[model samples]
Target: MPLGQPLRLGRHSVFPPLLMAPMLDITNRAFRTLVRGYGGCGLFYTEMLNARRLPTESAQSPFWQGLGVERDVMVQLLGDDPEALARSVERLLPLDPFGFDWNLGCARKKITHWGWGAALLENPQATARGLRALRQATDKPLTVKIRLPEHGHPDLFKSFIKLLENEGVDAITVHARTAADGFKRPARWDAIAQVKSWTKVPVIGNGDVQSAADAQAMFQKTGCDAVMIGRGAVGKPYLFKTIINQASGATEPAPEAAKVLEAMLTCLDTALETPKGAREFKVFCRYFAQTLPVPHWFWAPLQSMTLGPELAKRARVFFKK
Candidate 1:
């Protein structure tokens, strides 16, 4: 797949080449809808769901909660057990999602200890077997999210990628850093370029894409098919529009702080429909604070408030400045 081309991933084809990365606790249905409202995100992924929990009947389960079938959403599952992962996919298929993604790039310690998330990257054979199981279990498009090798062993990385390709993964999103490196190290765009050289499958480069210029630079440097924005999309939903405009040689009005706040409030309203409405609102507010120019005096009080209306009023007041 070339950098500016439409890449087919099983039943779906993504154009303009962008995806909203599956962010834990952040990329919920409400946030995905908010990004979609801004326009230009080619695909949207839900937050990572534990494969084990998907079988249980719980209202709070991320898999069961806040799922809106109307949007282009891919549900991401995290688990080390091949059977458990496969069974989870079978259960999720009835929802008729755009596709499914296996998460192999989260570096959180709890997930790593369970042999899930980025720990799967340490064992290429296990990862390949898991992919095979997932491929056989469901006809939906299968994608994997991976991080760059910490030891920089190109041969081993290529072998792992080849296993995914052989197993018929629709696409792969590379976070561009090793699990050990976390988010601190700069994304290795050159490594993505190397992967692009080796694979014909759609390769989506992810990491540190904060602006349209950053997206352009990643495309220019890596020659990958698409760009996936994670934290950068938070409090800045218009980022997708900006990137698309830049790619098409057009310009858009810069997103003002007030508009960003209004979007956050809209996201809050949607999130409130879910079980952990209050807690999720707090998480969203924390990120929104980062995007606003409000003083700590304003944010501190708002964070401590239990009332949603109070928080919204405070946010509006701060944004008006």
Candidate 2:
């Protein structure tokens, strides 16, 4: 159960097999850097990009910013058109990501309204064709994030996943809920088990993993090759380090509030290095706020402050108290 094992995805191998799920607007460079620094995430993904927008420099440009060549990162793209997706992949090759992942399972209404995301799951044939086109476009690793189908026989879900394996997808990450279920319903970890039984590629289980024990139970119950952390890591990048230590049978000291405060400031400094970074710092503060155990007395004043230096000073005083 050591987290050092390598996970083979087609021709590539990722150590630890723990990926930071591609959360839109939350998994940017500063956040990713903070997670990696804590030590456990094997891969990080960019915010979802649009295939149609990839051709233009302005649209494609955001995906390329703040990423380092040394980091293991993938660009997750949302689109329904196979040709357009292929062209986008072609355009992205020069940027040299660790891989490319197709966003098939995002249940966002705005995304599906444009004929993308989890709506693609409703049409398995088109999803297969899109995966094939993207596979042909690049030799880099390709993965599809999927949600378990709602109101279906288990056999039907198996059939859909088989089609993805048949089409040469490198791996599949199952989010354990249908589009209809939204975030309200409990994630179907049983469905993840069913998908693992059906697929030959690496299966990654995602959803409702909030603790190291949950991470272990996911792997034990589903027999998945990996586990992907989403909202669970927000305000707690140390969650990764804790999980890794637990998996390895090592005892890790509880991260002190002071240490957590330092990590947050480091993330703020990293975010502020970009254009309009102070604005992004405010966004980051929203997530960091979740980690505070006390009442709003600290965050209320910090939120009102506009300057980065002022915010950092307030944060130091808050943590000291």
Candidate 3:
């Protein structure tokens, strides 16, 4: 087993340093709270905030709030404009995030159309300009998430990260898939070591880390400082805790799946409310229902059903003890 340890991000301590990757609709306040309840996640990221839209968002919305019980939240931003990205960082100061993450990795066409996300990689100097402005915006720890170039070109990758380090990036998460490859190919776990060798900044490995075993393999095989999980943890929020428990030679099983679902439902009801609650919950259930041990009927219509008395009623019955 690889050694599990704490990571320091600015002033925060990420013990058992497994992170929940920031996803478009998956990492909401309520779901994060439920995930934290199981114990083991180090730092959780908010949704990728559009820098252009950040200034217009209400702090009271779930989009900007922190977990009332924990402070280890990282706010992630994406935008093409250096000025807007910088401005959003300042606007987010009140949330008192653990740090900030620049999304250099999202490949969705919609995000890239605005010259945001992975599209920024097409112009290293432009990426640098935004990074410089972001560095000026906050003294808090800053990180960037990225995917390798289309062919995993060695010189181009190293040159790009060199720019990030020069701009004072605290950590870098490499998703390990080339932009064009998408999910059609398996993540090249071996390449993480190359990044580890090339960068002075800490490297957090991402992509295909679907289980605690995968996390351990990542550490042993790639020597990454941390592993980031997104879809894998959607159905099993106790994933980090399981990794921690197993690493310590503990044989404990995860919290009962039924109890986990109930807690998630409660958080959705009581935690901070957002105008997008319904939509967020739908996206969450899409990943969630497919992963549980429940029969097909338990999840069959969840994607189409509206959340209300119907959803609550079915959950109570489907997951009933």
Candidate 4:
């Protein structure tokens, strides 16, 4: 029944109760700052960073590129080593992050091969120990993003969530899919509802929330404290504004094409500061193109573009009409 209320994560207050989920290379500082311009989402997360490497990583590392001293930003770490995770959190304290998130839901082979992400779920005992260590190490609000197990074990999964709460974790974000299911299966909204029913801690529901209706449905169906949007916000930074507005009983206004292009240009300009900005521009256009009129046609030609100037030129022409 929480409607547009600030979501509390232990001592932290996530206003608006909407979040931009962390996506590797997608939620960079430039992109996040651009999205925030729309002014709806309450929290933003950084790309997954390796806890084991934080101690030795230089500021020039891609992990640190967009991560300045921002308290509203949550840096997510992936690793199963309690000591390393603790040490990494300690080293990261200087950044003054809003909180720390453990990536327990990443299903990629790159992360799983390191015994991180969803692999930790394979050994619930060790995962608990690591989380306990993380809680003992810092007073900052701690959260975890997790995926359910491949096979159904409703009781067991529920117990694991309770265990996380017992270990001093403040909040949980359920992606509503199994580790093995990846993105192929539809997110099980019922699973999120079950977790919400069981835990006193705040729960953030993520997965397949593409539009304002999808977000509203998640809130109504699960009664979750917050809704985290990922791929849905790709080209549409205004999606946040749309959802927040509709949640507050305002009618959703479709974003003007010019507004979408402007946001893309801003992202492009900011990303252009990076070394591989051209490549980044290409990848970003791949998504932003979807928001344009005749997206399929726009997206096809955009794939061949690499430089920002060329892309911007094409974008200006596309929106000029």
Best-matching candidate per lDDT: 4
| Candidate 2 lDDT over residue span 28-135, tens digit each | 776787888888888888878888878665633645665545459988989999998999888878778888899988888999898699888878888988988998
The lDDT ranking, best first, is 4, 3, 2, 1
Q: In model 4, what lDDT does residue 276 have?
A: 65
* Cα lDDT listed for each candidate: 0.79, 0.80, 0.81, 0.82
lDDT of 1 by residue, 1-321 (tens): 123777578877887578998877677766777788889898889888888878664645554555535447888999978888888887777677888899998888999898888888878778987998899998878999998766647798898888878989999898998887777789888889888888888898998998888988888888888899987887677788888787677887977878877876776674554446555666666765665565778867866776666666776787777
Q: Each model's TM-score, in the order given? A: 0.91, 0.88, 0.92, 0.89
lDDT of 4 by residue, 206-240 (tens): 99998888998999999899999988887687788
**Tens digits of lDDT, candidate 3, 209-296:** 7788888999888988888988889878888888888888887766665687678888888441343676676676667766656677
Better of 1 and 2 by lDDT: 2
Clashing pairs in 3: none
Of 2 and 4, the candidate ahead on lDDT is: 4
Clashing pairs for model 4 are none
Instruction: Sort by TM-score, best first.
Output: 3, 1, 4, 2
Pick by TM-score: which candidate is best? 3
Model 2, poorest ten-residue lDDT window?
59-68
By lDDT, is 1 or 3 better? Answer: 3
Superposition error at 262 for model 2 (Å):
3.1
Candidate 1 regions exceeding 4 Å error are: 1-3, 59-68, 273-275, 291-294
In angstroms, give how far residue 198 of model 4 lies from its true place.
Answer: 2.0
- lDDT, residue 307, model 4: 63
After superposition, the stretches of candidate 4 with alpha carbons farther than 4 Å from their true spots are: 1-4, 267-270, 291-306, 314-321
